[model samples]
Target: MPTRIVVDPITRIEGHLRIEVVLEGNKITDALSSGTLFRGIEKIVENRDPRDVWAFVQRICGVCTHIHAIASVRAVEDALDYRIPKNANYIRNIMTLTQFVQDHVIHFYHLHGFDWIDVVSALKADPAQTSALAQSISGWPLSSAGYFRDVQTKVKTLVESGQLGIFANAYWGHPAYRLPPEANLMGVAHYLEALNWQKEIAKVHAVFGGKNPHPNYLVGGMASAININGNNTINIERLNLVKTKIEEAQTFVDQVLMPDILAIANFYKKDLYGGGVRNYLAYGGVPTVDVRNPDSYLFPGGIVLDRDLSKVYDIDLKDPKHIQEFVTHSWYRYDDPQAGLHPWQGRTEAQYDGPKPPYENLDENKRYSWIKTPRWQGKPMEVGPLARFIIGYARGNQRMRTLVDDALKKLDLPLSALFSTLGRTLARALETKYSVDHLAGFHADLVANIKAGDSAVFNPDKWDPSTWPATAQGVGYCEAPRGALAHWIKINKGKVESYQAVVPTTWNASPRDAQGQIGPYEASLLDTPLANPDQPLELLRTIHSFDPCLACATHLLNREGEEMLNLRVI
Candidate 1:
């Protein structure tokens, strides 16, 4: 008999997620991922001004807030055929890269680190040994015995006081944890350090976007105006502040984040459990000098099927035959449940007729999740750092290829290892290093352009809706920290006719399709071994590797402001 395990409201993530796995003995035979809440953001943005869509969409997820704004503005600009100023492009790039640095670091140290590091076990670590381990990895300034000792004492106090606060509710002494006490202590110390580091990193976003969580964005250009002398505009002092913050972020990545990931990877080199769907997709992000050209994108977009890197296919988001969403096993009412509709024609009418919540097992044959299956050319695709890394490595990108090769060499692992759970986590760390290293160059270019007297930021020509055609449609896409994200918008007489956002988690956390094909999250759980079915730490390791952000995936709320679906742990 297959033992069923249900983990509701998976903690430490952005939003509510419930994972159900049918385990035969100790290995997972099947799995189901459910996004329990729905915010109806697509419906809220309807009949609104097209220029202001980014502001509304930016609230989809607090963690992925800025990317939503960026994608929204890009979609509107695409429809208007608006070409923004070069300075605006550079400024946007800088902001995007800063978000990447802050998000990836936080994800690794805070969100996903607990999956590996045992906080309770850290209480037994020798601070001297932890310092030695840290020193062996890198010459980080904070790798001192005193620092590790203080971290160990703090953990001891938390454990003794029986109030871990943020460290509470974790599977602290799980058998799946492989790191030693010293390594766990090091991870915990860096975990606390990253909290302080991220605060400073957020200042970079405020410098350009006017706020941190949901920043201001303009369709034609960035919100910040370039003026070297004026106090009212983005003056020289503000630009210098941006430069200093970029340097601080870069130093942290080089000295702390990258080294810590490599150290953790060394401990779990042989554990190869979480290799999900091999088919990968990425809508290129971080545009270069030309925002319109895909070839100039820092992260190239393409589809790789069956892990075959040699044959990458170009994806046109506008092509109806390329990208489509299917709701056969989701709580959505489409004209045809089995049919896949392109985003421009997507609908979000809810139909929650599946099994009610507080149930033991999900009828996988029926609707199981609120997330619709998003397929690229009718195939399930994995997106995020792993996908971006694989796509970039396949495209012969020198910087990406070098980063992956060097990391693999350091770990003494073969290229095939990049397909496993550890590979996915390591990919995020490597990408962070690459993103932070390029921040200085982006800032320098922005300074040069501003000094050259190109102070233009916004284009007022298309700011009015009367200039638009009778009907216009466009797709705005960029790689969010989690994976590929795109917003499709349809406008008529200057008002939003239809707005659909196909987010990263929509692809990763989707359910089975009409043909009974499992999505990435479901497929990844097959054959995963469990040390303890009650704890299910091994399961979270794989799922968190994808960095699931359900806040952007499903968002339908009731009048009382409670989650409509009740998740019961059984």
Candidate 2:
């Protein structure tokens, strides 16, 4: 008989996620991914001004903040055919790059690092040996014996005090953790360092968007005012501040993050599990020119099926056949459960037909999740860093190919190694390094544009509702830190008639569709071996690789039609 293991509300992620697996002997024979919370952002934005939808939808996930706003505004702009100035595009790109640098680093260290690193194991490390390990990897300037000792002391206090705090409740000493004590200590030290350094990156968003974790975005372009001479606007000092932050991000990625990724990946090279679905998708972002032109995207957009790199299929957001959502095994209703509806025609009618809360098990044959299954041409696709890199490499983007090839060479692994959990982790770090390298060039371009007296960031030509057609619909797409994301909007007489968001997590964490096709998370768990069923650390390793964000995946719509605010999903 297969043993059922349920891990509800998976910790260290941005929102609520539940994973259940059936263990036959030591291998996972089946798995189910569930999003416990519901997001009602789409319902909240209905009948509202299309321009104001960004502010509402940006609240989908606090961690993935600005990407939602960017998608929202881009959808509205696409509907109205509005084009932003060069400076505005540059600023948005800079902000996005900063997010990539910050989010990826934070995800690797604070969220996913715990899977491979044992905080308790770090206590056994000799501070001197840890320093040697850290110094051997990179010149991060914080590899002193005393520094390791100090960081170890902090952990010791937490351990001895019986209050592990953020380091609490983990499966320490798990057999799956492959890092040695010294490497673990080094990683733990960087974890603490990252907690402090992440604040600096947030300042970049603040300098441009006026706030962090829900920055302001405009319909046409951005809300930031570019005036190098003005104190109130994006002045010379602000631009310099942005420059310094980007530099700090680059230094941290090159010296600390990448080295740590490479060092840790070396240990888990053979643990090549969790490849999941072979299909991948990337909407692509960081526009060098206009957002509408996919060719100008720094990360090229396309699809790769069955791990094939020879052919990259073009994705059309407006085409009903390209992208569609299904609620076959989800807690939602459609006239025909088997039919997949495109975003413009997507519905969010909540229908909880599964087991109630506090139940011991969910019927996998029925609706068990709140997240909708998103498919490209009826096929489930993996999204995020791994997909972007795969598509980019397939497209022969020189920089992307060089980065991936060099990383593969360093690991002494073949390109086929990229189809595993470790590959997902490596791809994120590489993407961060690549994006950070471009931040300077983007800042330089912004400076040049402003110097040339092109400081306009907003387009008021279509600011009025009357400027919009009586009925219009458009799709805004971008690659968020997690993966490919898009918003579909239908505006009627300047008011939003319908709005749908097919977020990254929806594509990855989605449950089985009508055809009984398993989504990425579920598929990834297939045939994965478990060293200890009680600990289940191997499960965390694979799931965390995708950096799941359940809040972004499942959105709620009250059947009673009441305004939903301050509803907590414990």
Candidate 3:
């Protein structure tokens, strides 16, 4: 019998999600996105001094909190037209990069690697071969032939460390697993090494942020003290190790990571070729080093679609009328569910009419998700590596096609094999490689500039809220680890009068809209045939590719009903 199979609380990703798969004889016919928890973030911000908003709002997502902090501070500064100093600008860039590295490394190895190699498989791996491979990989340490062996020892210690907090709910073994025991052992060793490298980078964040999961950076400037002899005198030797780490990481990508991607990808080729939207979007990545002109970002803005993987279009985020938050098929009580209301004024309430049947279509004029349907220029779009790659490729950037083509050849994959779970994972690793190499030179240049005596930090004294300024709005957009992320803010009386955000995962996991159009997750699930409806591991594999964060996804387990519905139909 054809029946609906929904994978509730989708694993691997950061957030909570339930895949609502409409089945008809082995194929999924439809889907719905549900962001089941609602935290009164905007409500919490109301009636508070504007200065504290950065601290509170940044807690929205542990992974991309830096971007949120940057966006919030920029919006407030824009409202007041408070121009910062040059030193402050550079400091922000360095700290933001630290956050980026911390996020990317942990996510790639610790979270994604477990799927390919089973824990038990590691027990059988040849330690000698592992050492040889580490020697060959540029970034991996091999000074002590004993280093690789030592890594295995640490993995055992970590397992017994009682800090399995990292893998508390993780699925170590699934039916789909298939790696040689040797490879599994090698992965186990690298997993421990990766964890160490992640902490190494995290210390960089700790030096500046006070903590890793969440940090402290003020709206006016940073909290850390930069030791500039006068103004432009920077502490070079102090930051050189970080520079070397970036270099080492680049080497690993070119040798170990990319090679492994090709090998593992060869096996998952079939899984690599589905769930592509062809519509790609990027939320203008982080700003460049030059403080004078920010439009020139380390990563720029634009959108690309199936027709051309080469050309990108500028996205104007400041257009209030161009954005919206729809709640039609969702479970909420609002007068105009389809209205383009700013986030601070937007309402959020969980009042499901009933458990929406998995296969049936809801009202054509309402929403079925707690996630607001955010349309860029009013259109559905996919964001993340594919989008970023398309934009960079269209611009004829050097590394774009080269990496994609090389990966395709290594995996023995055809041209049509992109945008699935494996591809997403590979794209992330590849991007980290590129960013590491790119930043190495920039960091060097920063050192040179500092030695020349130019440290610019802050240039503000005090201002009255009553006389702050007129109404001014700006949108800060950047690519979070998962995908394109954006923050839309409007300021009044020097406070966060209004704020709205559209994160990357939201793009992939949106719910049904008024027209019954499936959100990205729903759309991706349509063509994936569930082999065994009772055990939807394939469904889990696809969702985990995005690495979503349920904590930041605006959901909660209702202790009242003992109900934990992270995703549900309105």
Candidate 4:
């Protein structure tokens, strides 16, 4: 008999997530990904002014606040055929890039690093050997023996004190952990350093967006006003501050994050697992001067099926036949469970009539998750840094190719390895380095635009609802830190009639479709070797690689004010 393991409320992520795996002896034979909570932000936006939609949608996820705001505004702009100033685009790019840097670094070192580096193992490391390993990887200034000694001492104190804080309840010293004690120590030291580094980088968003989390965004342009001498406006002083922060973030990515990823990859080179859903999808982002042109996007959008890089299929979000969401196995009632509806025609009627929680196993034939299955051309697709990198590489993106090729060469791995769990983690680090390095150029462009006397930010022409048609619809999309995110809206008489968001996690964490095709999370766990069913460290390593964000995927609340279910972590 296959042993079933349930890990509810997967720790170290943004929102509630549960993973149920069936192990045939030591290998996973089946898996189920569940999103436990739901907050219906889509219904909340209904009957609201289109201009105010971004503010409400920004609350979708605290971690991915800016991306939702950006996507929301883009959808509105697309409906009105509005054009923002070039300076506005540049400022928006800088703010979004800063968020990406902050998010990716935090995800790697703080959230996902624990899976690879055992904090308890770090206590056994020789500070001198750790220092040598760190120095060998990069010329990071803090790679001194004394510096590592301090980190080791700190870990020892945390462990001996029996108060591990963030390191608590972790599968420490698990057999799945492959990093040496010295490597673990080095990672832990950098992990602490990242906490400080992220604070400085966050200032970039505040300087431009007026706040860090849930920054202010205007539909026609950015919220920041341009004035060379006024204290209230985004003056030269504020621009310089943003520049300095971007440079600081770049230095950390280059000297610390990138090198650390390569070092960790070296240790787990042979452990190939978690290459889920080879079909990749990316809605191109980081627009240059033109937001409408897909070709000019820094991250081009396309669909790659069956891991074939030679041909990339173009995706048109407006086409009802292209992108659709199916609630076949989700806790929602659609007009037809088998029929996939595009976001424009999407419905979010909650029907939690499935087997109640507190049950041991989910009936796969019935609804098991709150996340609806989002398919591109009726096929499950994986998104995120890995998808973006692969699509960029396939499209002859020289920078992406160069960065990926260089990393692969360093790890002594082939291009094929980019499909595995390690590759997904490494792609985020690579994209961070790329984003940080190019941020200066974007900043320079913004400065040039301002100096050339193009100081306008927000265009108030479309602020009035009377200017809009009786009905208009548009799709706004951008690649969030997790993956491709889009917000679809239909405005009737300047008020939102219908709104839907197909987030990144929805693409990766969906349950089985009507065809019984497993989603990325389920497919990835199949055949994964488990060291200990009780301590499923290997399972986490694969899932965390995608940096799951369940809060953004399923956002609804129970109005009954009753505890629907409880998770017992074992």
Compose the digit string of candidate 2's lDDT tens values, residues 1-570: 889999987888978888999999999999999988886889999999998999999998889899999999999888889888887899899888889999999999999999989999999999999998888889999999999999999999999999999999999999899999999999999999999999998999999899998988888878898778887999999989988988998899999999999999999999999999999999888899988777899999999999989999999989999999999899888999889999989998887777656678888899988899999999999999999999999999999999989988999999999999999999999999999999999999999888988889987888988766899998888889999999999999879999999999999999999899999999999999999999889999999999999889988877455533333433
lDDT by residue for model 4 (377-435), tens = 89999999999999999999999999999999999999999988899999999999888
**lDDT tens digits, residue span 1-570, model 3:** 667665665655665565666688866676666665555465456455666777877888767777677766776665566666555666567666665555666765676666666675455556777666545544445424466567566656656775655545544555566666555666665566666666666655564566676777665666655564423223454466557666665665566565565555656677652464666777656566542353666655577765365467766556555455556666655576566554435555555663454544443344445565655655667776666766666666667678777777777775456666677767766676666666665566556666677544555543456666656565555666667766656666656666666667767676665555566666666677666667665666666666766555563223232333444433
lDDT of 1 at 377: 84
Ranking by TM-score: 2, 4, 1, 3
Off by over 4 Å in 4: 557-570
**Clashes (candidate 3):** 24
Q: List the residue pairs that clash in candidate 4.
A: 38-555, 38-556, 39-555, 39-556, 40-555, 40-556
TM agreement with the true structure for every prediction: 0.97, 0.98, 0.84, 0.97
Cα lDDT tens digits, model 1, 408-431, are: 999999888989889999999999
Q: What is the descending lDDT order?
A: 2, 4, 1, 3
In terms of lDDT, model 1 sits at 0.89
Name the candidate, 1 or 3, with the larger lDDT value: 1
Candidate 3 TM-score to native: 0.84
Q: How far is candidate 1 from the true structure (C-alpha RMSD, Å)?
A: 2.0
Best of the two (3, 4) by lDDT:
4
Best by TM-score: 2
Better of 2 and 3 by TM-score: 2
